[model samples]
Target: MSTQTQTETIVLQPTPHTEANTNENESTQDQSPPEVKWMYPKILSAGLSFFVAGVNDGSLGSILPYVIRSYDISTDMVAVLYGTTFFGWLVAALTNSTMTQYLDLGPILCLGAAIQILAHVLRVWLPPFGLFAVTFFLASLGQAYNDTHANTFVASLHGAHRYLGFIHAMYMAGCLVGPFVATGVASANVDSKWYLFYVFPLGVGIANLALVGASFRDRMASALTSSRRRERRERNASGGALKEIKETLSISGVWLLSWMVEYLVNVRDGDVKQMGYVPAGFYGGAFLGRLLLAEPTHRFGERRMIFIYAVLCLGLQLIFWLVPNIITEAVAVSLLGLFMGPFFATGISVGTKIFPPELQSSAIAFVFVFGQIGGSVFPALTGIIATRVGVQVLQPMLVGLIGASGLSWLILPKDAELHRD
Candidate 1:
C-alpha cells in the first residue's frame, strides 16, 4: 500500500463515509506502487504462496497409490480423507470472513502457512490412518486462507489478468514438479515410503511463511484494533467472501486429475515411471495454458472463449477415453489440462469487475470455499463410486464435468455487459 493511503487510513475515524472511501482507495492503492518499491516482494510472495498450494495439491494424486497400499486401506479411506478435507474448507469458509474482519493480511496469511506446515509435519512422520486423514483438514484450512487472500490481492492489481495467470501458473508449475519429486521419493525403495515426499512441501511452506512475513512487514500490526469498527466490518464480510471458491477448483485438477495417473497405470497397463509422467504432462499443459491463454482469453473475452475452450476440452476428454493407444490417451489428457487451465484465473478476473469494491476480498474468499467444497466432494464421491465399480468410471464422469463446465459459463454475463456492471 502507498504511504499516504496507509497514513490516511491509520488516522481516519470509524465513520461510514470515511470507511467507504478507505475501502475504495484500497482497490487501486495497492496497485499504485509506493516510491520504496514494495509491490514486487509482495507479488513474489503471493506467487510462492500459490506454488506451495500447488505442491500440496499436485503431490496427492502421485502418492495416492502408495497411500492405499501402505495403509492397507480401501478407496473408501480416500473418501474419508476427502471428507476431512471438505470440513477443513468448510471451517475456513465459515470463519474466514470473521477472521478478515479483525485481522490484516499478514496475520491471516502467516496463520495459514503455520497451519499447513503443521499438516505436513504430521504427514512426514507417517502417522496413523485416522490422523493422516485429519491432516487434510488442516491443509485445506490453510490453503483456503492463502488462496482467498492472495487471489483477491492479485486480482486488484493493474494488470490483474496477467498477474492472476502468473500466480495460478505458479500453482501448475508446483503441480508439475510435485509428481516428479513425489514419484521419485515414493518409488525409490522396495517398500514405498511415500510419507517422505512431504518434506519438500514442508520446507517450502516454511519459506512461504517467512516470505509473507517479510513482504507484509509494513502492515503486520495494522489490524482493526478498535472495537468500535465492528459495524463497518460486518458489511465487508457479508458478500466479498463468495467469489474466492470459484478460483480454487484448479488445485487438485478436478476429478480427472486425481485419477489420471492411476488410469494410465492401471487401465492402460503402462509402467509407473512412464505413466506417472502423465499428471506432470497435464500440469505442464495447464502451465502453458495459463501463461499462453490469459491474454487471448482477455482479448477475445472470457465467457465466449472459455465456452469454446470447454467444448474443446470435452472433445479431448472423449478422445482420451475412446482411443485405445496409451500415447493417444496421454496426449489427450494434457490437452484437456491446457484448455481447462484458464478457467480459474479468468473467473477471478470477472468477479473483480462485477463485485462491489467493499465485498471483493471476502467475495473472493467465499469463491475459494465453494470450489474447495467441490474439489473435495466430487473426488470423494468418485473414490466411493470407484470402489463399487472401477477407476474406468473416470472417463464418463470427466466428460460430464467438462460438458457441465461449458454450460456453467453461460450463466456469467456477456462480454459487452461485463464492464457495465
Candidate 2:
C-alpha cells in the first residue's frame, strides 16, 4: 500500500479553529531552533540500532560455554539469563506505549542505548554471575525500545517495506558477524579474556546513541508535544496509552505473524536437528531473501505474498519432515528461511497501513512483543513436549503452526479505515 492510501484511511477528528491556532503556536515554539535534514541519518541510526541488538542476541550462545565454565554453573542454570531477557521484553511490552506519552523519540532512543551500553560494560568487566544475568535484562530492554521505535518510524516512510527489509537484513548481517567475533575473542584466551567479547557491542552501542541523538535531536520535544496536542484537540477518547495497547493486542495480524516467526525459528533448528552451521545457512538465506526479494514483494503486494511465503515455508517443512537425508534437510531449511524472510517486514508494513499514525508505535511494539512471546514460549513448549513425544514431533508441530498462520492472515482485515487516535 502507498503512503497516501494509508493517510487517507485515517479519520482525524477536526479541531476547533481557536485551539488549532494555539497548538500551532506552541508547536512552533517547541521545535528546535536549528532544522536538520534527518531522513538518511534516521535510517542509518535505525539500522545501527538493529545491528547492535542482533550482535547482542547472536553472540550470547557463542559465549555461553565460556560463561558456564567461568561461573562453574550447569547448563540448566543458563535459563536464568533467558528468563531475565524475557522479563526485559515483558517490561517493554507493558511500558513502551506509556513511555512514548512523555518521552520524545530522541530521548527514548538515547535511553535505550544507554541501557545497552551499561549492559555491555558490566559484561566486559566479567561482573559476578548475577550481575551478568542482569546485563541481559538491560540489553533486552534497550533493544525493545530501540527496535519498536525504529520499526514504527521506518514503516511510515515512502517505500517502507524495502527499507524495513534493509534494516532487518542489517540485523541478520550483524547476527552472522557476532558469533564469529565472540568465538574468536573467547578462544583467544579461553580461560580469562572471554568476557572481552562484549567490548565490541559496547563500542557499537555508543555509536548507536550518537547517531540516534544526532538524527532525532531537532524533532524530539516538538514531536511529543505535537502528538499530545493533536490527541487533545481531536478529543480522541481512544488515544490513551492503555487504549492503544488494548487495540493493538486485539489485532489478528499481530498474533498470526508472531506464530509464523515462532514456528520458523523452532522448526529450523529443532525439527531439522541440524548442526550449528546448518542453521547459519538458514540465516544466510533469510538475509539474501530480504535483500533480493524486498522490492518484488512490495510491488506484488504484502498481504498477497505473505500467504504465498507461508505456503512455501510449510511445503519445505513437510519436505524436511519426510526426507531423511541431512543434505536435503539443509537445502529445504534454507529455502524455508528464504520464503519466511519477507513475512516480518511485510507484516510491519501492513500494520502501518491499517493503523492510525498516533498509535503506530504502540501497535508495532505490541506486535513485536507478541512475536517475542511466541518465539520464547513455543520453543520451550516444544522442548517439554519433545521429552515425551520425541523431537521428531517438531516438524508436524511446525506444519500445523504454519497452516494456522496462513489461515489467520487470510482472515485479517486489509486496508481497512482506522480512526485517528
Top candidate by lDDT:
1
| Cα error, candidate 2, residue 145 (Å) | 1.4
Q: Which stretches in model 2 have alpha-carbon errors above 4 Å?
A: 1-36, 61-78, 125-128, 186-194, 220-275, 319-327, 380-397, 414-421
What TM-score does each of the candidates earn?
0.87, 0.74
Whole-model lDDT values for every prediction:
0.74, 0.63
Cα error, residue 233 of model 1, in Å, equals 3.0
lDDT of 1 by residue, 114-222 (tens): 9999999999978999999999999998987776677766766656788889998999899989989999998888877879999999999999999999987765655
Supply candidate 2's per-residue lDDT for 55.
80
Error of 1 at 63 (Å): 0.8
Q: Which sections of candidate 1 miss by over 4 Å? A: 1-37, 225-228, 236-255, 415-421
Superposed by TM-score, candidate 2 places the C-alpha of residue 189 at a distance from the truth, in angstroms, of 5.7
- Give the range of the ten consecutive residues with the poorest summed lDDT in model 2: 12-21
lDDT of 2: 0.63
